[model samples]
Target: MAAYGRGAGVAGREDLPVLLVAVLLAAAACSIAQAQQQPVYTSIYDVISNRSDLSTMKRLVDGLGLANQLTSGTFTAFLPDNNAWAQAFTAAGVTEAQMLTTYRDPATTLVNFHLVSRFTTIVNGSIYNNALKISDLAVNSTRSYDTEAGRADSDYGLALTRAGNDTDGAGGVQVMGRSGPPALIAANQSDIAAGLSYCNVISAVARFWFDTYFDIITKSSVTASSASFAGLVAAGGQQQWLKDTTLTGTLFAPDNAAIAKVQADLKLNFSTALSQQDAADLVRYHMTDVPFNRSAPVNPVATKLKDATLTWNGGQFLSVAGTLGRPSNNVRWVGFPRSASVVPLLDAALLPLPSTAWKLVVAKSAAAGASASSGFSSFIKAMEAQMVVRYQMDDTSKVVTVYAPTDAAFARLESYTGKPFASLASAIKDQIVSMHVTQGAAYTPSGLLTATPLDTMAGSRTLNVTRASNSAAGVQLSGGQTPRGAAAIVASDNVMYGRSIVHTLDQVLIPAGVVLPQGGGGAAGVASAPSGWALLLLVALAVCVQRWALAAA
Candidate 1:
């Protein structure tokens, strides 16, 4: 089949000859008399068969035994010339002598493609003046026609566009097909630009109906391995909306390797029943609302799925990174010839995290705390320097509850140390930071209020939790060193960073054996001396324990 057009509007072809003479005589009389005084015709078959240019279509209709049906119905047909027929014959590898015998049914289907079950007239000054007319792309005059491809619904159809002075100052008309740019409408041998009418039927010279572009679901089923699409289809991702051919769009299908990774990582086995919600959400993320062909404009395009969008990372070696390729409308379904959906064989399955979480960590974190002295910007910076937090960011399963120390808290830690936080050894700093996080569990502030002495990810150390009367002072977490005088929880229950739950603390909690000020008492100064041999041993122990714990994490 020839490539379907997508540019401007166009039409197609079929046959009738003995019917041509009568149509011409009627046309000649109308021209001689007033154009409005034309005789009322019996049906569309009369106009189509009488057109000398539509002889090939006439023969196809006759062979299909649909001549009588055409005469009795009200319909519109985009008839193509004999040139179009000759071209189709050449493409099918059949000569004109074998046209009736070799390509009978195929010719009939082609003719049926041109005949839409509605009466649409595109003449000057009519309701369709400079308007785009459309019809159901079917095999017959009604909804009951059936074929191997299934029944034709409103979702899968054809369109016609009329470009008047609005397009180019000079009026023009074009035909857009289902695939490539629409070709200019070829005039009939009679040189008539306007469509011919008989009774409730109208006929116009147009392009062929070559349904080459596959729908989104069909394209995915073909290009992607059974492992990927089969799971998707089972998950109900291939619903009627995806199967609609009338609306052109794109699909980002993952290959077998990607699907395998998802299965392994998510612990999903396609052998069992699919998780419909998860699979459907993932599939929706891969679909876009625009038809990004090679010629499509480069930009961030929105997807049908809410809050998800796609954009090209131009010049990015996506294949090297394991993605199919850069975002280009030019991408076709892998191993398929000219497909409808742009199937970029993704190296990995796309998993959409909660949008709110992504916005907090990646977007709002910086500006949100910029003006606050007791905000988490300093803790954010410190966490960025650690390799463990970075690893956790990429690991979807590791949920971490972080006790964020504000800028003022870091400054207080500096005052106690008599130096900047960075002046301390990296190992010591890592211990202090590790002491603030509770790994493998995300607790709400209410949960923490009743749970005291929680284990820290720094290996053996534990932190105390306390509940108070005032809302601001309701929940508190204290380091093992200082129980009564410790970091006051300023903000609580914030779970915006994926699996990471954040609770902003007003002060930095000191790890075990970290020295307190000279005037401090109680658990604040467990050691007899600051910088004594005992303090040295505790610091060394904290470092080793933290190193082991980080490795384990």
Candidate 2:
């Protein structure tokens, strides 16, 4: 009986251990289920109100009368914390009191820029909700989204840039306003409540778009790199145009370095009073009546200057082809406002006219003789023989495009005609040179490729411009006589001389009614054109002659 009692006691102890293990396992399962469940809330307003860091956002929403919209909409809110609001106010050099009083409309617009909605549409009798999640954004790329802000349909309300592979990590996402620095997303601050999503940002987005062009240009904090440009505007007495909110346009502002270089080159003194007419003309040349942004198409945009136009080529890097062929350096699209979009840090300023085409041709001939590539010795000789051609090449007032023949081109002509270019009659030489010069418009290579039949200086004669198969020399020009064929532009945008541009050609252009010396064999030996300092001296003499002739006239 005693042995049976001890065995029963041991069995009871064993059962005690098993019972404790079972209880522990059940509690672990319950905890896991609770962790996986999503939190529930009433609306986006409730979510913001519950967060201690988002007091500023809540106040702005309530003050702006936007609480009702946030209470029921399927929307996403990029809320700036109280700290962010404070920093933004400091940067803008304004207080919250001023925002509520003096800048109420802009403050309202600022709040609206933060809210984006999910679009609900019926497709094929089925409901679809196009709501964006942080996961939906591509890594390391900028994406545009529509916000509640009232802006043009073509304009982007918000530009979101995602940086890292981890979407949920800290500092992985940022939002850019029309200008200034981008606002960063705080870590683990994203939440969804009642179909509304919200993310807290560390800084407030800029409110530049609401300001006028003058306001932005003059703001030191906003445009520190563009101080020179702002000074030019002030000196030019064109502040009224930029300050006026009713006027809208685009300003291609050159940076301080570019402005300084141009000022020195042109012997300009912005510190002193300038002629209003000259200043106005210079200012107008840098602006366009229409506003253009980063998303603007690659097309010719008309500037305020009637004849001058700029071509903006859209890509990873934005570039503008102005009076000076597309600048060797890149042109950046800095930012935009409601009144104006400012593209800045241009390597060179856009001038109304470059240096004289004749001077450039003469310099090229001097630097490199007829035997070397890009030599224009023969073309120079032809121009020197014609006083009228010299006048056109040297004139700064008249814009023109010159399709200059290379020494090789003249050699080709000589080979075809069986007569040296120097032996040609003065009448024939004048006609040949005139046909190469297109007056009234200084077309860049890009302009020439797309231009219609262009009338040359040679009375009533037109040249047909077309695209060439050779990618290096992208353009071809055909004269009135078809049998003479086409002259390929060997080198395009070779020089930007005063109000004119030069393109090197492989063959001489022959206009109709001008008879060529008929022969098949090679020409006799001709006198070599001037070279070195001698050619340069000739160029100086030509300039003096041009000035004297103009002064006499």
Candidate 3:
């Protein structure tokens, strides 16, 4: 019997392939029969009708007369379930009947906001579309998608962020409206297919609210803790301007902690210490006419106050003019209202420097542990060499934009000319230093970009300021005799004595028509001869060699 069983097992192994094929055929037939029995859905309406939890959404779709559109077109609907609708109704302090009756237009808009169509536009040969799916988005990334609620030219949209792992399913995605907390997509309820349409169940309704700059700084919960700025604005009597929704701009509001620190350091009470005009100027210094958002590129922006500007290089903080050493926190655009666009929180108040240009340069150079490249000792010396330049810098009454070269810049000049800056003739040195000094107006980086052909103390020459189109390269200043044709503004907007501002340059600005003596074995490539001592040593060695040869002979 054992021998017979072993032989039977051998026979079964040999016929395994035929048996597997037969079983696979039977399973496929069963799957086909099951698929044929199930009803096919052709629209999002059909899918919503089947799910009892989405009854409120289904009713809204029908009431809004969007059933035909959803039934025929390719769309992705982010619908709030019945529970979500109930929460929204309670939060809104209205019933479903009231929404459908009195707020019909808003109700229609709400439904449309959830619907994303396959509409596309070609701009600059790039195709932009509204169609999006869970598979189309990457994990831990945010993307803005246009919805059906916007007009033809304008885009009203929601920002969608996918968190966690891509395989984490519906729970990984979050939907953010313009002005409220973000809503999460329900787990296991996303990407539900209904023929050409798809449905995703969300936790809550995405909501948008209208708030002006004044409303945000004063009343918004996001800025409640930072009420110091609101106090300053009110104290300045600029409430009317901020409250005006028609005036669209970006406002950098310093937080309470920052305001407190500035008050302590400056020893001034914002409410009592400041005069009306001074307070107004202080308030305006923090604001700009340009509206910047998360989508906007980081660039040098001019503020309402002359010579006060804000700049960010996609870094962790913003660099405000006059505060070169201190950088404020990065701008947050999440909670700002539609009217303001961006109201970033600043960690420091925008104020003028306590000293004059000459004093700042002297202090910076003399300060221990100061960076060689950042120091202006060479610049200070150059100014001192020219009494007129020193006198001009010392004068607090005259508002001037001093383009001071760093120690590194002077070193570069020496390396190029093969001589120290001090070795140059007094008249030439004065011209070189004067070319850097732009008198009459204090210009920030933003101001410099607009104001080209700036007149300098060197009356014969004018400096041409040009910035790269991309703005990442920063601002450059060109004059008659620059080493690289242009000198880059390394550090900008150092507020100094009175209205005077100082910008540190990477290279020295030499005036036009002033010729610099070329250094031997320098950048000019002129070969230098051996020194007198070296020549004597070479001749002595040759004589010794010759004497040894004669003695040997």
Candidate 4:
């Protein structure tokens, strides 16, 4: 019986080709049947009508009278599902009847933000090959399609970024609308089974749609024009510059009132002719490399203005600085666009830095640290001897966060090491000083509350960030080669040099060594807190650290 079974298996193997052909034929017939039954959408109306989830969107399309036009056009429609509509209704604080009647045009415009007139079907088969494709909304020519929201026509209008075989070498691919972060097609609602597939293009319902983009120039001109920044157009020739669609940037526009006050403080007349240097300084101080959404608070971002850079964290709530005359002093967000935002500052323009962070530090070190009143002489001498300050100041890419110790901190280090700081080898001095710096990342006092395991410029070493018992201590950041104690970030965000953020530490951070100073491994050094001017000396040391990183870069 076993021999007969083996022979039968062999015969089946020999007839495998015929069996495969039969299976293929069956599959072909099934595909033909499925194709015959496939629902054809003559218009977007048919597509929306087929899905119960898209009922709200269908009402919008019908209300706009775009059913006939959409049916014959090739386009990609990002229809919001029923859940999205419910959320939108709740957010807008309106009932469905009121939305259709009182808010019809506004509702139509909101719906139009989702529609892109193009054949933007995601080729599912090609996605496995890791292709990255982006669609820059091409058909946005007139108010009929995309109504101009802010000052100019949309520059970053509804971009569709598709990644087939994600370039990051990650296994899965994603499709993103330039509204926010990209959503995974396979992971999200790739539920096209219920969709009205057409020959021209297919529409898949999106989890969410992108926000409407507004140009910075347009937002500034309309919202900040009256009281906020009337002279921004006149003083800096910003009217012509911003209107040019080719350039994109973040403009921190001071209100005309604020500008006038600043001018009075400087004793300069706005109406009179000014030097090219002064006008450039006034304009550049308000400019940042990246565009920020004034409507929302932002994470701590670096500004291009270097010395008088606009640096603030999401927690700072800068919008709260100029809005009303109440206790909160909030700044008003006068514009709605994401690409270009207009924020009103009631007080003054950001002043330009006299020199780079490195130069400022070098001066401070010489003036304060080397002086009899300041105790940072030993630390300054060692740094100057090594020329570490030069290296740190030269690098532009790195934003060195220095936890500089006062002269007293160095005195304690000298007492522990059984040698003067200046006597140590150049290599040892470099390692010791480098241990005090956390490279690349910049954290404000508020940002430090959550950041931890901060990597130092010293390779492989790390530090922990924690809040002080008294909020006045700002934040304590500490770590080393060994388990020596924490240093209090006494004065935080007090210094900005080029891109370097300087924080003054109450005690010097010593990496692991045999000579641990008394109370160095513990929080016993808090008594030697730096005065306000002493804190400036600590910032000077950061310039030295920046120079080192720059040389390496």
The number of the candidate with the highest TM-score is 1
Model 4 scores worst on lDDT over the 10 consecutive residues at 319-328
lDDT tens readout by residue for model 1, 55-159: 777777777777886776544445566776666556445665554566565445445655545434556857541212222222222122122112233122344
| Angstrom error at residue 129, model 2 | 2.3
Cα lDDT computed for each candidate against the true fold:
0.52, 0.67, 0.69, 0.49
Q: Roughly what TM-score does model 2 have, to 2 decimal places?
A: 0.43
List, residue by residue over 51-106, the lDDT tens digit for candidate 4.
Answer: 67678777777776766655655444555566666765664457666656786654
Candidate 3 TM-score, C-alpha based:
0.40
Top model by lDDT, which number? 3
- Residue 103 Cα positional deviation in candidate 2, in Å, after optimal superposition: 5.6
Clashes of 2: 6
Model 1's TM-score against the true structure: 0.44
To one decimal, what is the Cα RMSD in angstroms of model 4 from the true structure? 25.8
- Residue 65 lDDT (model 2): 79
**Prediction 4 TM-score vs. true:** 0.32
Worst 10 residues of 3 by lDDT: 330-339
The whole-model C-alpha lDDT of candidate 1 against the native structure comes to 0.52
lDDT of 2 at 490: 73
lDDT of 3 by residue, 56-172 (tens): 988888877888877777778888989988987886667888767776766776787787656676999999754567666787798666677753112246677887664224456
